[model samples]
Target: MDLATIWVTFTSWAGAYSWQVIVTLAIVGLYFLIDRLTIPVLSRSADNARLTESSGDRAVGLARLLTGTLCALAMMVVWGVQFGSVLVFAGTALTLLGVALFASWSILSNITAYFVILLHPTFRRGTFIRVLDADNYAEGYIADLGLFNLKLITENREAIVYPNNLLLGRPCVINPRDRLRGVGKLPPLPPLDVVPNNE
Candidate 1:
Protein backbone atom coordinates (compact mmCIF):
# COMPACT_ATOMS: atom_id res chain seq x y z
CA MET A 1 0.00 0.00 0.00
CA ASP A 2 1.08 3.60 -0.51
CA LEU A 3 2.30 5.62 2.53
CA ALA A 4 -0.92 7.68 2.58
CA THR A 5 -3.03 4.53 2.37
CA ILE A 6 -1.02 2.84 5.17
CA TRP A 7 -1.28 5.96 7.33
CA VAL A 8 -5.02 6.12 6.83
CA THR A 9 -5.42 2.44 7.67
CA PHE A 10 -3.34 2.77 10.83
CA THR A 11 -5.23 5.82 12.04
CA SER A 12 -8.61 4.19 11.38
CA TRP A 13 -7.61 1.06 13.24
CA ALA A 14 -6.19 3.02 16.15
CA GLY A 15 -9.27 5.21 16.33
CA ALA A 16 -11.57 2.24 16.29
CA TYR A 17 -9.84 0.62 19.30
CA SER A 18 -8.46 3.64 21.10
CA TRP A 19 -11.05 3.46 23.88
CA GLN A 20 -10.33 -0.22 24.48
CA VAL A 21 -6.61 0.43 24.69
CA ILE A 22 -7.07 3.32 27.08
CA VAL A 23 -9.42 1.33 29.30
CA THR A 24 -7.02 -1.58 29.46
CA LEU A 25 -4.11 0.63 30.37
CA ALA A 26 -6.18 2.45 32.99
CA ILE A 27 -7.31 -0.83 34.56
CA VAL A 28 -3.73 -2.09 34.75
CA GLY A 29 -2.46 1.18 36.18
CA LEU A 30 -5.17 1.22 38.83
CA TYR A 31 -4.24 -2.30 39.90
CA PHE A 32 -0.59 -1.35 40.16
CA LEU A 33 -1.36 1.66 42.31
CA ILE A 34 -3.62 -0.35 44.60
CA ASP A 35 -1.04 -3.10 44.92
CA ARG A 36 1.65 -0.65 45.86
CA LEU A 37 -0.56 0.94 48.52
CA THR A 38 -1.89 -2.34 49.90
CA ILE A 39 1.32 -4.31 50.33
CA PRO A 40 2.92 -1.94 52.80
CA VAL A 41 -0.29 -1.78 54.83
CA LEU A 42 -0.39 -5.55 55.03
CA SER A 43 3.27 -5.69 55.94
CA ARG A 44 2.82 -3.11 58.65
CA SER A 45 -0.16 -4.99 60.05
CA ALA A 46 1.88 -8.17 60.03
CA ASP A 47 4.62 -6.44 61.95
CA ASN A 48 2.13 -5.09 64.49
CA ALA A 49 0.74 -8.59 64.85
CA ARG A 50 4.22 -9.83 65.66
CA LEU A 51 4.27 -12.12 62.67
CA THR A 52 7.58 -13.28 61.27
CA GLU A 53 9.02 -11.76 58.12
CA SER A 54 8.10 -14.89 56.21
CA SER A 55 4.55 -14.66 57.45
CA GLY A 56 4.40 -11.01 56.41
CA ASP A 57 5.63 -12.02 52.98
CA ARG A 58 2.96 -14.70 52.74
CA ALA A 59 0.25 -12.23 53.68
CA VAL A 60 1.53 -9.87 51.00
CA GLY A 61 1.38 -12.72 48.50
CA LEU A 62 -2.23 -13.48 49.40
CA ALA A 63 -3.15 -9.81 49.07
CA ARG A 64 -1.49 -9.74 45.66
CA LEU A 65 -3.47 -12.78 44.54
CA LEU A 66 -6.74 -11.19 45.62
CA THR A 67 -5.79 -7.88 44.04
CA GLY A 68 -4.86 -9.56 40.79
CA THR A 69 -8.11 -11.49 40.68
CA LEU A 70 -10.15 -8.34 41.20
CA CYS A 71 -8.11 -6.51 38.60
CA ALA A 72 -8.68 -9.32 36.10
CA LEU A 73 -12.39 -9.12 36.69
CA ALA A 74 -12.33 -5.35 36.18
CA MET A 75 -10.40 -5.75 32.94
CA MET A 76 -12.94 -8.23 31.67
CA VAL A 77 -15.74 -5.79 32.44
CA VAL A 78 -13.88 -2.91 30.80
CA TRP A 79 -13.28 -5.06 27.71
CA GLY A 80 -17.04 -5.67 27.40
CA VAL A 81 -17.37 -9.15 28.87
CA GLN A 82 -20.96 -9.82 29.87
CA PHE A 83 -21.33 -9.56 33.62
CA GLY A 84 -24.08 -12.18 33.82
CA SER A 85 -21.92 -14.67 31.96
CA VAL A 86 -19.04 -14.00 34.25
CA LEU A 87 -21.24 -14.49 37.27
CA VAL A 88 -22.57 -17.77 35.98
CA PHE A 89 -19.09 -19.05 35.27
CA ALA A 90 -17.79 -17.91 38.65
CA GLY A 91 -20.75 -19.45 40.44
CA THR A 92 -20.31 -22.78 38.73
CA ALA A 93 -16.62 -22.86 39.49
CA LEU A 94 -17.19 -21.89 43.11
CA THR A 95 -19.88 -24.52 43.54
CA LEU A 96 -17.46 -27.15 42.31
CA LEU A 97 -14.76 -25.83 44.58
CA GLY A 98 -17.16 -25.87 47.53
CA VAL A 99 -17.98 -29.51 46.94
CA ALA A 100 -14.32 -30.43 46.63
CA LEU A 101 -13.43 -28.52 49.78
CA PHE A 102 -16.37 -29.88 51.81
CA ALA A 103 -14.60 -33.13 52.52
CA SER A 104 -11.58 -31.15 53.71
CA TRP A 105 -13.41 -28.40 55.59
CA SER A 106 -10.83 -28.33 58.33
CA ILE A 107 -8.14 -27.70 55.74
CA LEU A 108 -10.00 -24.71 54.42
CA SER A 109 -10.62 -23.43 57.92
CA ASN A 110 -6.95 -23.71 58.72
CA ILE A 111 -5.98 -21.80 55.63
CA THR A 112 -8.33 -19.01 56.60
CA ALA A 113 -7.04 -19.15 60.13
CA TYR A 114 -3.52 -18.69 58.82
CA PHE A 115 -4.41 -15.18 57.73
CA VAL A 116 -6.17 -14.52 60.99
CA ILE A 117 -3.08 -15.51 62.94
CA LEU A 118 -0.88 -13.44 60.69
CA LEU A 119 -3.03 -10.33 61.07
CA HIS A 120 -4.07 -10.65 64.69
CA PRO A 121 -1.94 -10.02 67.74
CA THR A 122 -3.13 -13.07 69.63
CA PHE A 123 -1.02 -15.75 67.96
CA ARG A 124 2.48 -15.11 66.69
CA ARG A 125 5.65 -16.96 65.85
CA GLY A 126 8.38 -17.57 68.44
CA THR A 127 6.27 -16.98 71.53
CA PHE A 128 5.48 -19.75 74.04
CA ILE A 129 1.84 -20.65 74.39
CA ARG A 130 -0.34 -23.24 76.03
CA VAL A 131 -3.38 -24.60 74.28
CA LEU A 132 -5.99 -25.47 76.85
CA ASP A 133 -7.82 -28.40 75.44
CA ALA A 134 -9.31 -30.86 77.87
CA ASP A 135 -8.25 -33.87 75.85
CA ASN A 136 -5.22 -32.61 73.98
CA TYR A 137 -3.60 -29.87 75.98
CA ALA A 138 -0.25 -28.87 74.49
CA GLU A 139 2.38 -26.25 75.23
CA GLY A 140 5.28 -25.20 73.17
CA TYR A 141 7.35 -22.45 71.66
CA ILE A 142 5.98 -21.20 68.37
CA ALA A 143 8.34 -22.46 65.70
CA ASP A 144 6.70 -21.78 62.37
CA LEU A 145 3.31 -20.75 61.17
CA GLY A 146 2.27 -22.79 58.16
CA LEU A 147 -0.77 -22.46 55.91
CA PHE A 148 -2.56 -25.38 57.56
CA ASN A 149 -0.93 -25.49 60.96
CA LEU A 150 1.34 -23.87 63.50
CA LYS A 151 4.58 -25.64 64.27
CA LEU A 152 5.60 -25.67 67.90
CA ILE A 153 8.69 -26.95 69.62
CA THR A 154 8.00 -28.24 73.08
CA GLU A 155 10.36 -27.73 75.97
CA ASN A 156 11.36 -31.35 75.48
CA ARG A 157 12.11 -30.58 71.83
CA GLU A 158 9.15 -32.50 70.43
CA ALA A 159 7.63 -30.79 67.38
CA ILE A 160 3.89 -30.40 67.35
CA VAL A 161 1.91 -29.49 64.28
CA TYR A 162 -1.26 -27.95 65.62
CA PRO A 163 -4.01 -27.15 63.21
CA ASN A 164 -4.73 -23.41 63.00
CA ASN A 165 -8.47 -23.85 63.30
CA LEU A 166 -8.10 -25.76 66.54
CA LEU A 167 -5.87 -23.08 67.94
CA LEU A 168 -8.39 -20.42 67.04
CA GLY A 169 -11.18 -22.20 68.87
CA ARG A 170 -9.24 -23.23 71.91
CA PRO A 171 -8.21 -21.16 74.87
CA CYS A 172 -4.59 -20.08 74.51
CA VAL A 173 -2.33 -18.80 77.26
CA ILE A 174 0.58 -16.72 76.11
CA ASN A 175 3.64 -16.59 78.30
CA PRO A 176 4.61 -12.96 78.59
CA ARG A 177 8.18 -13.93 79.24
CA ASP A 178 8.45 -15.95 76.01
CA ARG A 179 8.48 -13.11 73.54
CA LEU A 180 9.40 -13.67 69.90
CA ARG A 181 13.04 -14.70 69.57
CA GLY A 182 14.13 -11.70 67.54
CA VAL A 183 11.42 -9.32 68.71
CA GLY A 184 12.66 -7.44 71.73
CA LYS A 185 9.43 -7.32 73.70
CA LEU A 186 5.81 -8.26 73.54
CA PRO A 187 3.27 -5.50 73.10
CA PRO A 188 1.58 -4.62 76.37
CA LEU A 189 -1.58 -6.54 77.03
CA PRO A 190 -4.87 -4.94 78.00
CA PRO A 191 -5.66 -4.70 81.72
CA LEU A 192 -6.31 -8.02 83.41
CA ASP A 193 -10.06 -7.54 83.44
CA VAL A 194 -10.26 -3.80 82.67
CA VAL A 195 -12.25 -3.51 85.92
CA PRO A 196 -11.93 -4.01 89.63
CA ASN A 197 -14.52 -5.75 91.74
CA ASN A 198 -15.55 -3.17 94.27
CA GLU A 199 -18.18 -5.39 95.85
Candidate 2:
Protein backbone atom coordinates (compact mmCIF):
# COMPACT_ATOMS: atom_id res chain seq x y z
CA MET A 1 0.00 0.00 0.00
CA ASP A 2 1.07 3.62 -0.53
CA LEU A 3 2.58 5.46 2.44
CA ALA A 4 -0.43 7.75 2.87
CA THR A 5 -2.92 4.86 2.64
CA ILE A 6 -0.97 2.81 5.15
CA TRP A 7 -0.72 5.70 7.58
CA VAL A 8 -4.42 6.54 7.41
CA THR A 9 -5.47 2.93 7.71
CA PHE A 10 -3.21 2.08 10.63
CA THR A 11 -2.93 5.31 12.57
CA SER A 12 -6.29 7.09 12.26
CA TRP A 13 -8.60 7.01 15.26
CA ALA A 14 -12.07 5.50 14.85
CA GLY A 15 -13.66 8.97 15.02
CA ALA A 16 -11.52 10.09 12.04
CA TYR A 17 -13.15 7.45 9.84
CA SER A 18 -16.40 8.93 8.53
CA TRP A 19 -17.82 5.72 7.11
CA GLN A 20 -17.15 3.72 10.23
CA VAL A 21 -18.73 6.30 12.52
CA ILE A 22 -21.78 6.62 10.33
CA VAL A 23 -22.31 2.89 9.97
CA THR A 24 -21.75 2.17 13.63
CA LEU A 25 -24.11 4.93 14.76
CA ALA A 26 -26.75 3.76 12.32
CA ILE A 27 -26.59 0.20 13.60
CA VAL A 28 -26.68 1.29 17.22
CA GLY A 29 -29.60 3.61 16.62
CA LEU A 30 -31.49 0.94 14.79
CA TYR A 31 -30.84 -1.51 17.56
CA PHE A 32 -32.33 0.82 20.16
CA LEU A 33 -35.32 1.64 18.01
CA ILE A 34 -36.02 -1.98 17.30
CA ASP A 35 -35.69 -2.87 20.95
CA ARG A 36 -38.13 -0.18 22.02
CA LEU A 37 -40.62 -1.19 19.37
CA THR A 38 -40.43 -4.92 19.90
CA ILE A 39 -40.64 -4.99 23.68
CA PRO A 40 -44.26 -3.93 24.12
CA VAL A 41 -45.33 -5.93 21.09
CA LEU A 42 -43.61 -9.07 22.27
CA SER A 43 -44.86 -8.55 25.82
CA ARG A 44 -48.40 -8.37 24.53
CA SER A 45 -47.92 -11.49 22.45
CA ALA A 46 -46.49 -13.35 25.39
CA ASP A 47 -49.40 -12.26 27.54
CA ASN A 48 -51.69 -13.90 25.00
CA ALA A 49 -49.76 -17.13 25.10
CA ARG A 50 -51.59 -19.64 27.25
CA LEU A 51 -48.84 -21.97 28.28
CA THR A 52 -46.16 -19.61 29.44
CA GLU A 53 -44.86 -16.06 29.80
CA SER A 54 -41.38 -14.82 29.04
CA SER A 55 -39.36 -12.38 31.11
CA GLY A 56 -39.10 -9.20 29.10
CA ASP A 57 -36.15 -8.05 31.15
CA ARG A 58 -34.05 -11.06 30.17
CA ALA A 59 -34.79 -10.70 26.48
CA VAL A 60 -34.16 -6.97 26.52
CA GLY A 61 -30.94 -7.36 28.43
CA LEU A 62 -29.64 -9.97 25.97
CA ALA A 63 -30.51 -7.88 22.95
CA ARG A 64 -28.92 -4.73 24.31
CA LEU A 65 -25.72 -6.57 25.20
CA LEU A 66 -25.34 -8.30 21.84
CA THR A 67 -26.13 -5.13 19.95
CA GLY A 68 -23.64 -3.14 21.98
CA THR A 69 -20.99 -5.76 21.26
CA LEU A 70 -21.68 -5.49 17.55
CA CYS A 71 -21.30 -1.72 17.76
CA ALA A 72 -17.97 -2.09 19.57
CA LEU A 73 -16.64 -4.55 17.00
CA ALA A 74 -17.63 -2.20 14.22
CA MET A 75 -15.61 0.50 15.95
CA MET A 76 -12.67 -1.86 16.23
CA VAL A 77 -12.76 -2.57 12.52
CA VAL A 78 -12.72 1.15 11.92
CA TRP A 79 -9.53 1.32 13.97
CA GLY A 80 -7.88 -0.51 11.05
CA VAL A 81 -7.35 -3.95 12.49
CA GLN A 82 -6.25 -6.49 9.88
CA PHE A 83 -8.69 -9.08 8.56
CA GLY A 84 -6.61 -11.85 10.14
CA SER A 85 -7.20 -10.27 13.57
CA VAL A 86 -10.94 -10.90 13.34
CA LEU A 87 -10.70 -14.19 15.22
CA VAL A 88 -8.90 -12.54 18.08
CA PHE A 89 -11.53 -9.85 18.14
CA ALA A 90 -14.22 -12.52 18.12
CA GLY A 91 -12.68 -14.25 21.11
CA THR A 92 -12.39 -11.00 23.00
CA ALA A 93 -15.96 -10.19 22.16
CA LEU A 94 -17.08 -13.57 23.48
CA THR A 95 -15.29 -13.00 26.76
CA LEU A 96 -16.97 -9.64 27.15
CA LEU A 97 -20.31 -11.19 26.25
CA GLY A 98 -19.87 -13.84 28.93
CA VAL A 99 -19.08 -11.26 31.57
CA ALA A 100 -22.08 -9.14 30.61
CA LEU A 101 -24.38 -12.16 30.77
CA PHE A 102 -23.05 -13.14 34.15
CA ALA A 103 -23.66 -9.68 35.57
CA SER A 104 -27.15 -9.52 34.11
CA TRP A 105 -28.00 -12.92 35.56
CA SER A 106 -26.90 -11.75 38.96
CA ILE A 107 -29.06 -8.63 38.77
CA LEU A 108 -32.09 -10.49 37.44
CA SER A 109 -31.84 -13.12 40.13
CA ASN A 110 -31.87 -10.45 42.83
CA ILE A 111 -34.91 -8.67 41.38
CA THR A 112 -36.82 -11.94 41.12
CA ALA A 113 -36.27 -12.62 44.81
CA TYR A 114 -37.92 -9.39 45.92
CA PHE A 115 -40.89 -10.05 43.66
CA VAL A 116 -41.46 -13.45 45.21
CA ILE A 117 -41.41 -11.97 48.69
CA LEU A 118 -43.95 -9.29 47.77
CA LEU A 119 -46.28 -11.88 46.26
CA HIS A 120 -46.50 -14.14 49.29
CA PRO A 121 -49.84 -13.79 51.06
CA THR A 122 -48.50 -13.53 54.58
CA PHE A 123 -45.35 -11.55 53.86
CA ARG A 124 -45.33 -7.93 54.96
CA ARG A 125 -42.81 -5.27 55.79
CA GLY A 126 -42.50 -6.35 59.43
CA THR A 127 -42.88 -10.11 58.99
CA PHE A 128 -40.31 -12.75 59.86
CA ILE A 129 -38.90 -15.15 57.30
CA ARG A 130 -37.56 -18.59 58.12
CA VAL A 131 -35.89 -20.78 55.57
CA LEU A 132 -36.84 -24.44 55.81
CA ASP A 133 -33.59 -25.81 54.44
CA ALA A 134 -31.28 -23.16 55.76
CA ASP A 135 -30.96 -22.58 59.49
CA ASN A 136 -31.19 -18.81 59.14
CA TYR A 137 -34.04 -16.53 60.08
CA ALA A 138 -34.66 -12.88 59.22
CA GLU A 139 -37.08 -10.98 61.43
CA GLY A 140 -38.06 -7.35 61.23
CA TYR A 141 -39.54 -5.09 58.63
CA ILE A 142 -38.67 -5.91 55.03
CA ALA A 143 -36.54 -2.91 54.17
CA ASP A 144 -35.92 -3.59 50.53
CA LEU A 145 -36.21 -6.54 48.21
CA GLY A 146 -33.28 -6.50 45.83
CA LEU A 147 -32.63 -8.57 42.74
CA PHE A 148 -30.04 -10.81 44.40
CA ASN A 149 -30.92 -10.40 48.07
CA LEU A 150 -33.49 -9.33 50.60
CA LYS A 151 -32.72 -6.31 52.72
CA LEU A 152 -34.25 -6.98 56.10
CA ILE A 153 -33.99 -4.90 59.22
CA THR A 154 -33.90 -7.19 62.22
CA GLU A 155 -35.61 -6.29 65.50
CA ASN A 156 -32.31 -4.94 66.72
CA ARG A 157 -32.14 -2.75 63.58
CA GLU A 158 -29.35 -4.63 61.84
CA ALA A 159 -29.55 -4.84 58.06
CA ILE A 160 -29.46 -8.31 56.54
CA VAL A 161 -28.81 -9.28 52.97
CA TYR A 162 -30.22 -12.67 52.14
CA PRO A 163 -29.63 -14.26 48.79
CA ASN A 164 -32.57 -14.29 46.41
CA ASN A 165 -32.54 -18.05 46.00
CA LEU A 166 -32.60 -18.54 49.74
CA LEU A 167 -35.39 -16.04 50.19
CA LEU A 168 -37.43 -17.84 47.55
CA GLY A 169 -37.13 -21.12 49.40
CA ARG A 170 -37.99 -19.67 52.80
CA PRO A 171 -41.45 -19.74 54.28
CA CYS A 172 -42.86 -16.32 55.15
CA VAL A 173 -45.33 -15.56 57.91
CA ILE A 174 -48.08 -13.71 56.10
CA ASN A 175 -49.91 -11.49 58.59
CA PRO A 176 -52.83 -10.52 56.36
CA ARG A 177 -53.58 -14.02 55.15
CA ASP A 178 -53.38 -15.51 58.61
CA ARG A 179 -55.49 -12.74 60.04
CA LEU A 180 -58.20 -13.12 57.36
CA ARG A 181 -59.97 -15.79 59.40
CA GLY A 182 -61.95 -14.83 62.50
CA VAL A 183 -59.54 -14.83 65.44
CA GLY A 184 -62.31 -14.79 68.07
CA LYS A 185 -65.44 -12.87 69.07
CA LEU A 186 -65.29 -9.17 68.22
CA PRO A 187 -66.52 -6.31 70.47
CA PRO A 188 -69.98 -5.02 69.58
CA LEU A 189 -70.12 -1.66 67.80
CA PRO A 190 -72.77 1.01 68.18
CA PRO A 191 -75.21 1.57 65.26
CA LEU A 192 -73.30 2.51 62.07
CA ASP A 193 -75.69 5.45 61.26
CA VAL A 194 -75.22 7.07 64.70
CA VAL A 195 -71.42 6.61 64.64
CA PRO A 196 -71.12 8.41 61.32
CA ASN A 197 -73.40 11.34 62.26
CA ASN A 198 -70.47 13.79 62.60
CA GLU A 199 -69.34 13.25 59.03
Candidate 3:
Protein backbone atom coordinates (compact mmCIF):
# COMPACT_ATOMS: atom_id res chain seq x y z
CA MET A 1 0.00 0.00 0.00
CA ASP A 2 1.00 3.64 -0.32
CA LEU A 3 2.36 5.66 2.64
CA ALA A 4 -0.95 7.49 3.11
CA THR A 5 -2.90 4.18 3.19
CA ILE A 6 -0.42 2.68 5.71
CA TRP A 7 -0.53 5.80 7.85
CA VAL A 8 -4.31 5.84 7.87
CA THR A 9 -4.49 2.18 8.95
CA PHE A 10 -1.90 2.67 11.68
CA THR A 11 -3.53 5.80 13.13
CA SER A 12 -7.00 4.28 13.01
CA TRP A 13 -5.80 1.15 14.79
CA ALA A 14 -3.96 3.17 17.42
CA GLY A 15 -6.89 5.52 17.92
CA ALA A 16 -9.30 2.62 18.23
CA TYR A 17 -7.20 0.61 20.77
CA SER A 18 -5.15 3.24 22.59
CA TRP A 19 -7.29 3.22 25.72
CA GLN A 20 -7.25 -0.57 25.85
CA VAL A 21 -3.51 -0.58 25.50
CA ILE A 22 -3.08 1.97 28.27
CA VAL A 23 -5.41 0.11 30.63
CA THR A 24 -3.80 -3.25 29.89
CA LEU A 25 -0.37 -1.80 30.62
CA ALA A 26 -1.60 -0.14 33.78
CA ILE A 27 -3.19 -3.35 35.04
CA VAL A 28 -0.10 -5.44 34.31
CA GLY A 29 2.25 -2.94 35.93
CA LEU A 30 0.08 -2.68 39.01
CA TYR A 31 -0.15 -6.45 39.25
CA PHE A 32 3.63 -6.82 39.26
CA LEU A 33 4.08 -4.04 41.80
CA ILE A 34 1.40 -5.48 44.06
CA ASP A 35 2.85 -8.95 43.69
CA ARG A 36 6.33 -7.83 44.67
CA LEU A 37 5.03 -6.03 47.74
CA THR A 38 2.44 -8.63 48.69
CA ILE A 39 4.70 -11.68 48.71
CA PRO A 40 7.22 -10.16 51.12
CA VAL A 41 4.49 -8.86 53.41
CA LEU A 42 2.74 -12.21 53.40
CA SER A 43 6.01 -14.00 54.07
CA ARG A 44 6.73 -11.71 57.01
CA SER A 45 3.23 -12.23 58.34
CA ALA A 46 3.66 -15.98 58.12
CA ASP A 47 7.00 -15.74 59.90
CA ASN A 48 5.53 -13.60 62.64
CA ALA A 49 2.74 -16.12 62.98
CA ARG A 50 5.48 -18.74 63.58
CA LEU A 51 4.63 -20.61 60.41
CA THR A 52 7.18 -22.64 58.53
CA GLU A 53 9.23 -21.06 55.73
CA SER A 54 7.47 -23.22 53.25
CA SER A 55 4.21 -22.04 54.65
CA GLY A 56 5.31 -18.53 53.82
CA ASP A 57 5.97 -19.77 50.31
CA ARG A 58 2.51 -21.28 50.14
CA ALA A 59 1.10 -17.93 51.21
CA VAL A 60 2.98 -16.30 48.39
CA GLY A 61 1.46 -18.78 45.96
CA LEU A 62 -2.03 -18.08 47.24
CA ALA A 63 -1.46 -14.35 46.99
CA ARG A 64 -0.31 -14.72 43.41
CA LEU A 65 -3.43 -16.66 42.52
CA LEU A 66 -5.73 -13.99 43.94
CA THR A 67 -3.82 -11.08 42.49
CA GLY A 68 -3.55 -12.74 39.10
CA THR A 69 -7.29 -13.37 39.04
CA LEU A 70 -7.94 -9.72 39.79
CA CYS A 71 -5.54 -8.65 37.06
CA ALA A 72 -7.30 -10.93 34.56
CA LEU A 73 -10.66 -9.45 35.47
CA ALA A 74 -9.35 -5.92 35.08
CA MET A 75 -7.95 -6.71 31.67
CA MET A 76 -11.24 -8.29 30.70
CA VAL A 77 -13.02 -5.13 31.70
CA VAL A 78 -10.60 -3.03 29.70
CA TRP A 79 -11.24 -5.27 26.71
CA GLY A 80 -14.98 -4.81 27.10
CA VAL A 81 -15.91 -8.41 27.84
CA GLN A 82 -19.63 -8.74 28.50
CA PHE A 83 -20.65 -9.43 32.12
CA GLY A 84 -22.94 -12.26 31.06
CA SER A 85 -20.18 -13.85 29.01
CA VAL A 86 -17.79 -13.60 31.92
CA LEU A 87 -20.29 -15.33 34.18
CA VAL A 88 -20.92 -18.11 31.67
CA PHE A 89 -17.22 -18.68 31.10
CA ALA A 90 -16.44 -18.71 34.78
CA GLY A 91 -19.28 -21.14 35.48
CA THR A 92 -18.25 -23.52 32.72
CA ALA A 93 -14.60 -23.38 33.72
CA LEU A 94 -15.37 -24.06 37.36
CA THR A 95 -17.69 -26.88 36.47
CA LEU A 96 -15.02 -28.51 34.35
CA LEU A 97 -12.38 -28.00 37.01
CA GLY A 98 -14.63 -29.42 39.69
CA VAL A 99 -15.45 -32.43 37.55
CA ALA A 100 -11.76 -33.00 36.89
CA LEU A 101 -10.79 -32.86 40.55
CA PHE A 102 -13.95 -34.33 42.05
CA ALA A 103 -12.23 -37.59 42.90
CA SER A 104 -9.56 -35.73 44.88
CA TRP A 105 -11.83 -34.22 47.49
CA SER A 106 -9.12 -34.45 50.10
CA ILE A 107 -6.96 -31.98 48.18
CA LEU A 108 -9.63 -29.32 48.32
CA SER A 109 -10.30 -29.96 52.00
CA ASN A 110 -6.61 -29.75 52.81
CA ILE A 111 -6.27 -26.39 51.07
CA THR A 112 -9.18 -25.03 53.11
CA ALA A 113 -7.52 -26.41 56.24
CA TYR A 114 -4.39 -24.35 55.61
CA PHE A 115 -6.09 -21.24 56.93
CA VAL A 116 -7.37 -23.12 59.98
CA ILE A 117 -3.82 -24.18 60.77
CA LEU A 118 -2.50 -20.67 60.16
CA LEU A 119 -4.92 -19.09 62.60
CA HIS A 120 -4.22 -21.68 65.32
CA PRO A 121 -1.47 -20.08 67.39
CA THR A 122 -0.51 -23.31 69.15
CA PHE A 123 0.01 -25.22 65.93
CA ARG A 124 3.07 -23.76 64.27
CA ARG A 125 6.63 -24.46 63.23
CA GLY A 126 9.04 -26.04 65.76
CA THR A 127 6.15 -26.99 68.05
CA PHE A 128 6.09 -30.54 69.36
CA ILE A 129 2.73 -32.11 68.62
CA ARG A 130 1.00 -35.43 68.97
CA VAL A 131 -1.94 -36.63 66.91
CA LEU A 132 -4.04 -39.38 68.39
CA ASP A 133 -6.11 -41.66 66.28
CA ALA A 134 -8.18 -44.70 67.21
CA ASP A 135 -6.05 -46.97 65.05
CA ASN A 136 -2.63 -45.42 65.69
CA TYR A 137 -1.09 -42.33 67.26
CA ALA A 138 1.67 -40.05 65.93
CA GLU A 139 3.85 -37.49 67.68
CA GLY A 140 6.44 -35.28 66.10
CA TYR A 141 7.81 -31.78 65.58
CA ILE A 142 5.57 -29.67 63.44
CA ALA A 143 7.74 -28.70 60.49
CA ASP A 144 5.81 -27.33 57.55
CA LEU A 145 2.21 -26.58 56.64
CA GLY A 146 1.86 -27.11 52.94
CA LEU A 147 -0.99 -26.66 50.51
CA PHE A 148 -2.33 -30.19 50.94
CA ASN A 149 -0.40 -31.53 53.93
CA LEU A 150 1.29 -30.92 57.24
CA LYS A 151 4.86 -32.14 57.54
CA LEU A 152 6.04 -33.56 60.85
CA ILE A 153 9.52 -34.65 61.78
CA THR A 154 9.56 -37.50 64.28
CA GLU A 155 11.93 -38.08 67.17
CA ASN A 156 14.04 -40.37 65.05
CA ARG A 157 14.21 -37.67 62.35
CA GLU A 158 11.73 -39.44 60.12
CA ALA A 159 9.43 -37.26 58.01
CA ILE A 160 5.71 -37.79 58.28
CA VAL A 161 3.69 -36.09 55.57
CA TYR A 162 0.28 -35.94 57.17
CA PRO A 163 -2.75 -34.78 55.28
CA ASN A 164 -3.96 -31.38 56.50
CA ASN A 165 -7.61 -32.43 56.66
CA LEU A 166 -6.77 -35.56 58.62
CA LEU A 167 -4.52 -33.66 61.02
CA LEU A 168 -7.35 -31.25 61.77
CA GLY A 169 -9.77 -34.14 62.14
CA ARG A 170 -7.72 -36.00 64.76
CA PRO A 171 -7.21 -35.01 68.37
CA CYS A 172 -3.97 -33.06 68.81
CA VAL A 173 -1.69 -32.36 71.78
CA ILE A 174 0.77 -29.51 71.83
CA ASN A 175 3.82 -30.19 73.99
CA PRO A 176 6.29 -27.34 73.92
CA ARG A 177 9.96 -28.22 73.69
CA ASP A 178 12.90 -26.76 71.76
CA ARG A 179 14.06 -29.02 68.99
CA LEU A 180 17.60 -27.81 69.63
CA ARG A 181 17.40 -27.41 73.38
CA GLY A 182 20.34 -29.69 74.12
CA VAL A 183 22.53 -27.58 71.85
CA GLY A 184 24.52 -24.82 73.55
CA LYS A 185 23.28 -21.73 71.68
CA LEU A 186 19.49 -22.11 71.54
CA PRO A 187 17.38 -20.23 74.12
CA PRO A 188 14.89 -21.64 76.55
CA LEU A 189 11.41 -22.63 75.40
CA PRO A 190 8.32 -20.53 76.09
CA PRO A 191 5.07 -21.64 77.70
CA LEU A 192 2.93 -23.20 74.97
CA ASP A 193 -0.68 -24.10 75.68
CA VAL A 194 -1.51 -27.75 75.72
CA VAL A 195 -4.79 -28.50 73.89
CA PRO A 196 -5.84 -31.82 75.32
CA ASN A 197 -8.48 -34.01 73.79
CA ASN A 198 -11.57 -34.03 76.01
CA GLU A 199 -12.61 -37.35 74.56
lDDT to native, each model: 0.75, 0.54, 0.76
Q: Provide the TM-score for each candidate, comma-separated.
A: 0.69, 0.38, 0.60
> Which candidate wins on TM-score?
1
* Model 3, C-alpha of 142: deviation from truth (Å): 0.7
TM-score ranking of the models: 1, 3, 2
Model 1 scores a C-alpha lDDT of 0.75
Write the residue-wise lDDT of candidate 2 on 1-199 in tens digits. Answer: 8999987776676546768777768877877787788667544433332112334344445556656777667666765777559768788867865664344345455454544444444444445543333333344455554446656665566776767666665564433222211222323446666555575
- Which portions of model 1 show Cα errors greater than 4 Å? 1-11, 48-52, 93-106, 176-199
Tens-digit lDDT track of model 1 for 90-124: 78866765664343454676767777777677666
Q: How many clashes does each candidate structure show, in the order listed?
A: 0, 5, 0
- In Å, residue 131's CA in model 1 sits off its true spot by 1.7
lDDT of 3 by residue, 128-179 (tens): 8877676456778888888788888887888888888788888876884434
Native-structure RMSD, model 1: 8.1
What is the lDDT for 43 in model 3?
70
